[model samples]
Target: MTLNKDHIGGLIFLTIAVVYGYFAHDIRMFPGDQFEPFNAQTLPIALAWAGGLISLVMLATAGRSAEPKPTLVNLDFMLVGKLMVLVWLFAQALSWIGFLAATILFLLVGYWLLGERRIRTLLLASIPFAVGFWLLLAKVLDIYLAPGKLWQLVLGA
Candidate 1:
């Protein structure tokens, strides 16, 4: 079978997903049950395995598909650079800006950089994403993301 861009891309993604799952599976579990019938780490482990399995299926399906011409690996330097800078900023500000505010800032910056137009659209899209992401990490995950010094001093983290 001829290996095209689709097949190769799928294969790489699958491999990375499997590797991520493997590492996640190796972490030590927390002692004592915080929630009934479920430990803190259970969902993460389940998600990792599911991701790995999905990737495997994707790779298998791509391998069996019809081949197309390979496309050149052109990097979108501007987008990549912007994303990287934003990610770095997020990491640096995580301990200072709290979860919700930092998430909103990142989402807004990301949306604008990715060519999203309309102030209303950007505002609408960012709100849910920031709130949902914060809720997921803080509540469902039962993990405390750094609420930042400002939040800590104000809200008492």
Candidate 2:
């Protein structure tokens, strides 16, 4: 049997899911801290299980197709590289600019890079998302997010 992309991708996905699930399962929770129904490990574990199941289905159906394999020439390596660089920059900026500011910048730049040229739309989308997510984490979830070193220095807070 010929090994197709699906087979390889399925195996990789399944392996990642298993590893992620394993690590997620090892998360430690504080004693008597049961305010929330879901803990830190909940989302990761759920996503890992979902990914593993989908990967298993892909692996099972991979050998049933006899169609001609598609070439990789259509894949845009430059776009992928740009996205990778953006992700790295976002990670670095998170500590420097904090979550809300970094996320807003990331979303704006990411949308622009992906061909969304409307400034109004970008502002409408990114600002609400950044603020909503910040509120969700900080207010609703009672999580503490850094207000950024730059903001701290500038505002003298």
Query: For this target, which candidate reaches the highest lDDT against the unseen true structure?
Result: 2
The TM-score, computed over Cα atoms with residue i paired to residue i, of candidate 1 is 0.47
Collision pairs in model 1: none
Q: lDDT by residue for model 1 over 1-157, one digit each (tens)?
A: 6776666777776777667667766766565554447765577667777767776676678766676657556968778988999999988777898778988988888999999988998999999988998899889988877668987788875
* TM-scores of all predicted structures: 0.47, 0.55
Error of 1 at 156 (Å): 7.0
Write out the backbone clash pairs for model 2. Answer: none
Model 1: how far is 20 from its true place, Å? 25
Off by over 4 Å in 2: 1-70
